[model samples]
Target: MIRLHHVAQTRSFRVLWMLEELGLDFDVVPHSFFDRSLRDPAYLALSPAGRVPALEIDGRTLCESGAILQYLAETRGTLTGTPEERPDWLEWLHYAETVGSHVANLTQHHIILRDPAMRSATVMRLEAKRLEKALEGIERRMAGDWLLPSGFSAADIAVSYGALIGQRFTALDRLPKVSAWLDRLNARPAFQRAAARDGAAQIYMQAFYPPPEETPHA
Candidate 1:
């Protein structure tokens, strides 16, 4: 049986959406970032870093979400894209983390820090700008409806996770293609299914977390 450890609105959502896209029958082992459950020894055994998206499949467990997506696509013989497009596919897949890093920093400053004093307005503004630039790269690279010219592939599912969440910290107004692409992704049936199973909002209580206003230096 395939089992996926998931937390709503986390990077694990990438794996959850991927599983739905592949039409795989799997159980979602729900987890929370608020509770100390992730720190437990049992969960850690599955994910050494105490992170989400730890998947149990084919008699072995996988931790990283990107790796899981590649394994599933290759083993299932679908969504891997054409062999000639492998380089682009792999590049987009890993680039998801570039977008994610900014989101993580923004989330930490905007949400996880709890006390306002503990959060750095400078970091928030900087990360938001960085996230916006990363998304701009996606917009510039979009020559079609999806990341790859070969149509929808696992690369879309892998990288879109960041765009989906990054919007909270960074506006997509100028990135029209990225916004349109996100709309198309949200309209997918598999993406809808994953959203239904995404559990409750344990994090990101606000609809939008705007970056702090820029301080003018004298």
Candidate 2:
């Protein structure tokens, strides 16, 4: 069975969600970011950066949410696009990583964190625009329900996770297709189970954020 070292409120939720989607029973070893438990030696052995959502399979350890999604897709074969659709699937997967990372960075740094004194307003504005363009790019291609030519796959999972994280910035209102797609994805029973698992971990992380500043503001 796969063992997931999950941090409650992070991208690890996506991994748990994917596993549930696959109908695979995996073990969860919850780690808390608030206590900095992720940086502990044991967890660091599995993830060099002590990040959440580390997966233990057989004996090998896997980190990074995108890689985990790909591993699951390739391993299960069920999360795959058709033969002719492979190129498109691969493209969208890359899109998720490249475009999604930018989106998450903007949302987390600017919107979620109360770092007005620390954040760069100019940079955040630029990131927001970049994210908007990326969303528009995806919207142009998302003619059908899924992101790829074929049905739902790992590519969709990866993109959906990115979309959910970044939704705080764009909202479904600005991107109707993406919103509709997320609605469809979330409606899945498996996705709901995954969400419940991820939500449990997130509730655990609420204790971590809003760190103390180096110099107290006068």
Q: In lDDT terms, which candidate is top?
A: 1
Per-residue lDDT of candidate 2, residues 1-218 (tens digit): 78999866577887888898898888999887658788789889999988878999867999988888888888887787888888888788778876777765675665456667877655666666677788777778894988766678888887777677666555456788888898999898988887777645343223222322345559
After the best TM-score superposition of candidate 1, give how far the Cα of residue 72 lies from its true spot, in angstroms.
Answer: 0.8
In lDDT terms, how accurate is model 2?
0.75
Minimal lDDT window, size 10, model 2: 203-212
C-alpha TM-scores of all predictions: 0.97, 0.85
lDDT of 1 by residue, 81-114 (tens): 8899999999999999999999999999988999
What residue pairs clash in candidate 2, if any at all?
8-201, 8-202, 9-202
Q: After best superposition, candidate 1 residue 86: deviation in angstroms?
A: 0.4
TM-score winner among the candidates? 1
Off by over 4 Å in 1: none
